[model samples]
Target: MDKCFYRRGKVSLSGTIVAVGIFMLIAVRGMGQTGNNSVYRLTIAEAIEFSKSQNKWVQTANMEVNAADEDRKDVIRAKLPIVNVNGSYQRFSGLTLFTDGLSHATTGERKPTPNSAALGIDALFNIYGGGRQHALEEEQHLRVNLARLNAQDQSGNIALQTATQYLNLVKLNDLEKFLADQLNRARFRLNNINALYRNQKVTRSDVLRAEVNLSNVELSLEQNENDIAIANQHLDVLLNVPDSVIIIPADSAGMTKPEVSSLLQLTQSAEVSSYTVQKAATSVDVQTAKLRSIRSANLPNVSFYAAYGLNYPNYLFFPPVNQAYSVGFVGLKAQYGISSLYHNKSKIAAGKIRVKEAAMQREAYADNVRLDVRSHYVKYVEALRRIEVNEHSVEQAEVNYRIINNKYLNQLALLTDLLDADNLYQESRFNLIKAQTDALSIYYHIRYASGNL
Candidate 1:
């Protein structure tokens, strides 16, 4: 009876182990599938938001702005009182005695301790810098503004890029669906031909032809799937997501067309609102401030300084012995670099030239912005027209395919004709998607050029 009980216990334990193993296997498989099929659904706006928050380029630009702020703070700190402290220690082996000056008699040697130490603190405040300090402060302020404008420009560029990628993904999704339908149709045609062959109503050659067509369609479907993968990977990079994650557009209809003003109005707005133009204008101001700072170099610098320190073995007494005492002094100081009077002319001239160069570059950028706005506007209009034409083409292709399919079924049309009509239908649908996506992309491009994005 004990043996019997042992056998039963063993059996039960084995069964439990097997059950647990099965459960673990099932759990792991479920987890793997979930990981493989992770999907993130995002709209265009959400995608742009994600890019702004997560994109490396945008983050770097923000860091630049922070660095510029710190630099500005440094410049301001330079104008405040500066304080420093220092200490020193020294060791001597012996002391030397010197003769008295009036009597010309040698004095006995007085040797002090071998160790000595001293500590001191000093402070200085700029009383004047010939206006150079103010110019430096202004220049640093402009640098901060320039960094901010640069960040704005980077954000706009990132937004436009994200929008474009999002739209491209939408287009790829539409193409995927279309290709799937085409694949299904091809398979159905092959099955129909096989049935006809079994009934001896169609030749074997016809079956072979249908098989070939199906194979071609299958290849095209596979290629379309690869394209989808590539598009998803690009979106992942933009949104700062893992490459394995698939991004799906929640709204496949694409972005709405923004109401744009006239080209002249857009150009005018761009001149004022464009981050590039603003940065360039600030650059000119910065250069002008720099020139003022350079000119200030020729003037005198005035400052007030004070120092307090303790010294060992004061030298006021002859044959001095070791003693400690505090000494202090305060005074106003003025200094000028005489060479600046003769050498600063060339530097000043160069600074002026740089200011002029900056102004010229700003003007050139404005001209380019106007050209860019007009070009994008024209592309947007053309895309709109294409979308209209393709919409009608899709309708016509659908009608033509239906007629061809019916005739083929009635044994009055060839498979080639039916296939051709189907291909045309798919192409028209693809064209429509492309046109819509292009229109939206071009619209964002226009906004980007105008720095409104």
Candidate 2:
């Protein structure tokens, strides 16, 4: 599935690829190089892939995911103990010890070491944080997931955009080809009219009519050529190609008809797979985790601490010693914030509100996702029906054109009648091509709405 989204838009396994291949085989070929520029050819799948890598929104989303992952790692590290090894050397200007403050003989204790060196190691690990650490880790993990979902959503968006633009370019190219065909027919009609007028079989009015028709087709062809050129430049910008490079799609739209069972099925699928819904759901989890973290402040904080130190002229004794001494101790420490009892109350209440808000927001997004999926599916069905309708119209117009062309050749029909038939035929062809492309567009839009694209 080119749509396996780099990660969820997986399409019909091998069948779709083969179908696309066959369709493109019959679709438009390369438009050749634009004047004096490098010709870059692209297919629809290739265009979508380019959009994922080159589109700024997708790039930004990917960056967010990376940052979120790093954050999650940081949160995990927060649970680990902090260890420090510290050392210092010092020469004292004067040493003073006050033994007479607690006993007699102050002068004897005052004869202390003039220099000292000390080293210490300490480790502190949280024994308890009212479960705040775990909650924080959970929130960070969910945020990382949320970021990933956002990235998937962005990838789907860019892919859909690229596909839509690519299809538009293809539709215009198809029209240009059709119009060129009509232009040829117009010239042939005009030449035949001139021959008939020279033989005095048709009036000059008829010849003038044919010439006017030929000019009209010429003007239309010119307009389409210009549009195609503009489409080329737009595509270059869309693909994020260098200004010096032009991307001409080697495409002939051959989108396989999307197989959908029902709107209910799609809605259900979206609930399970949709990135928008998933992101919203993750948001709820994030908020819930945050609330838990906030509530954790209600419990007393506790930690285990261990420290070992060596120092000259030990100060732990009543009389200061000149020799070095070492001490090590390990114990648990506990603390409770008296202010948090009151301060945390409002914060927890607000946190609870936010959790509810987040849940409601998830529901809202899920609702919109379902609606979007349903609407697109309906449009897809309509587009498919239109393609059917336009196809029959094309058949009828083709027959009508043939009949009128024959009648005009037999001198049994006016030039105006034949020109009308030609116009109808062209219009019908244009409509069919348009319907085909529209159906494909709607199909992808449906996928995008469900976060599958």
The lDDT of each candidate is: 0.79, 0.79
For model 2, how does the per-residue alpha-carbon lDDT over 55-144 read when each residue is reduced to its tens digit? 667767878988999999998998899999999997766534556585643332233677778899999999899999999999999998
TM per prediction: 0.83, 0.82
Off by over 4 Å in 1: 1-37, 89-92, 96-118, 194-206, 260-267, 316-324
Candidate 1 lands at a TM-score of 0.83
1-453 in candidate 1: lDDT tens per residue? Answer: 111011101112354355345434544554565554456556676567556656677768878888999999999999998999989988775554546755554444345656677899999999998899999999999999898788778878887888888888888889889988988988898888898789887788888988888898788888878888988888788766678777778667444554445344655687666777888899999999999999999999999999999877665576656898789999999999999988999999999999999999999888877777778887877888888799899999999999998887778898789889989999999999999889888877776787776
Give the RMSD in angstroms, all C-alphas superposed, for model 2: 6.0
RMSD of each: 13.9, 6.0
- For candidate 2, give the lDDT: 0.79
